[model samples]
Target: MTGNLHAGALLLAAAPIGRPEDASPRLREALSAAPVVAAEDTRRLRRLAGDLGVAVTGRIVSYYDQNEASRATELLAELLAGRDVLVITDAGMPGVSDPGYRLVREAVAHDVRVTVLPGPSAVTTALVVSGLPTDRFCFEGFPPRKAGERSRRFAALADEPRTMVFFEAPHRLAATLEALAEAFGADRPAAVCRELTKTYEEIRRAPLGALAEWAADGVRGEITLVVGGAPEPAGLSDPADLAAAVADRVAAGTPRKEAITAVAKENGVPKRVVYDAVVAAK
Candidate 1:
């Protein structure tokens, strides 16, 4: 059924990544007022509510990855019934590498109003605190677990020009860092932020190789990784070098015109210069 004027909205709440006090006032109000609270971890939600000195007055249900699909259907029904269903994850915003996506999508499909209670996020927290270029960046979530998949994924991103953020478990941090070092480069600048916004929080900024070595000694707490983007290739002034660069891209199946444009941009030269070089070589 389509939503009516009295239909309830779906609230996607952001939980504090570490400190309970980071919880927003709107979140506290929603916790106490929502007709149904879908939590990634009910136990952890209870603890957070208690720590916030706010008792949740709604029915609490588990809504983690295992039952996300089925639970989304149920929650959508609740919204359709004029009951606000608040979705919260263990930490950070719901549906961010988390379980709220299905419910949000369902609610939208059913014309149920959906909104967000934005607050703390590990992605931005790490990126801002990493001292890296924040003008342009991307969140990669987590790397693939299998060695082959992870290697291929990193290889694909090796030429990415924007700062990158990632979430990773403490247990796999060492191996992941090593793999990133191998794929990106040993000297790539990176930061490993652990237990952010909590006691004993640590931000270790170093080259990928050194961070890999440090993590091998064993680290703890939640982890967020920030890595610098690939450095711009040195500007090519030599016509031979510029022509060769375009030729290499053309050989790799890139269109000649597109290759010339890319080579011009990469080497801080003009398109005319690269075009002339390509023509001169031909």
Candidate 2:
């Protein structure tokens, strides 16, 4: 219903994260009315359609990660032919750590109209439910698979003030939590949401260290992790305090210049202030 009349529009549909009942009415209509439906998993699409009691009259094609690039071209052709194409993933919105991004990019390149049928989102759902600050937040879809890369990524984000949301596989949950605790400190608050909106939905809120221990036993189902932002350091205005903070980092093998910058950022002070304090302490 939201596409251009002359050229077929690309519709990005958001599927329910868990329950079929959470699917939007617009999505049901799109499934029935679109000329072509590109689904990440054709079998899951059919099952979802059946659950909604709607018969899909459109041509359903597989558009998963393996076939995403090659299939995007075919779907784009359908759009140029004035046939509306609806993209749906296994759960949640398409192009969100899922297939459909390539097609959306191609469609835009060819001047194809694009629209969205928004519904449930695991990112926002997990953020609100986690009781973390919602005013500012970011979604980090998944962490690097390698231990070294993951550690570096977390280190870079250690000073990020906005709440962070992440999606992760069950098998990697324990290791990821442990790495997070190391990077963000064991006392940092976080929440692990599993099987959101499902019958066995669970949310565990605790310090990063405790959650790491809890996940060591293993977990199942989909996972969304929400971690509170780095807390601002308090009452470290004294030059001796700043110098001591830099000295501690230097003793731990961090470069003096880097340590000064880090301490300044962490305490909401200027780099010059920290540098001057370090020099004066010498």
Candidate 3:
């Protein structure tokens, strides 16, 4: 907001998600420059500072979800006191799945100027490497952990045309994949991105079913999943049940290119025939 900016500056810095070496030079400079540092995990922050060989002269304070509300007023007070304050989360950008959202919102409401230190983010990184359509996309964040809620959640996004991205825990990855397969259909194209920029980083592109089966053995580390979207609706020339199968895949998460390929391959028909039918249907 204008209050802080007019008075001084409040910086929102992005912390490394996994690899500490990803720390930007500006971030390191900001760490030492800012007088007060509000960190999600002070211990980790201290360790990062040590690794970077930067001595922080700032007064470190904890600002996590549990204490953010009460701490916000104090942090804002620091800004109002004409002290430059820097906020950092444990990983990635703050507010995506981290702290600092409330403080930022309050700062804006109170006319305190807010600035962000742009850096690595799992959401965008996963999307670009996902190999799905990237022209248009939406980050769904993390899906519900429970089976019932998770199933219902995936059911809602069954027809999302843009590439969809989600964060999943390693232990829950298998169940999540299975649920996606059932909700979006087993054959829908998808990719699982794990350990983003870290050394063991891996991106597996395959149908949802194949990933689900692989996850049965259990996958670990930070997981980002990108699922293909609903396919264009078309008709079949099976003379028996072309429209039904096409509609099923379309409702699931099969795009035109994939749907045409899968339907023609399954029904013993020409790909052009299915493509024309879909175009006419639309």
| Model 1 accuracy (lDDT, Cα) | 0.93
Question: For every model shown, what is its TM-score relative to the native structure?
Answer: 0.86, 0.88, 0.80
lDDT of 2 by residue, 1-282 (tens): 344457798999999999999988898899999889999999999999999999999899999999999999999889989999999999998998999888989888788899899998999999999998999998888999999999999998887899999999999999999999999999999999999999999999999999999999999999999999988767479999999999999999999999999999788787999999999999
Which regions in candidate 1 have their CA more than 4 angstroms from the true location?
1-3, 235-240, 243-282
Note the Cα lDDT for every prediction shown: 0.93, 0.93, 0.85
User: What residue pairs clash in candidate 3, if any at all?
Assistant: 1-111, 1-112, 1-113, 2-111, 3-111, 4-112, 231-254
For model 2 the local lDDT of residue 14 reads 96
Q: Encode model 3's per-residue lDDT on 81-120: one tens digit a residue.
A: 7888999988888888778888888877777778889998
* Model 2 vs truth, CA RMSD: 3.9
* Model 3: how far residue 152 lies from native, Å: 1.4
Using lDDT as the measure, name the better of candidate 1 and candidate 3: 1
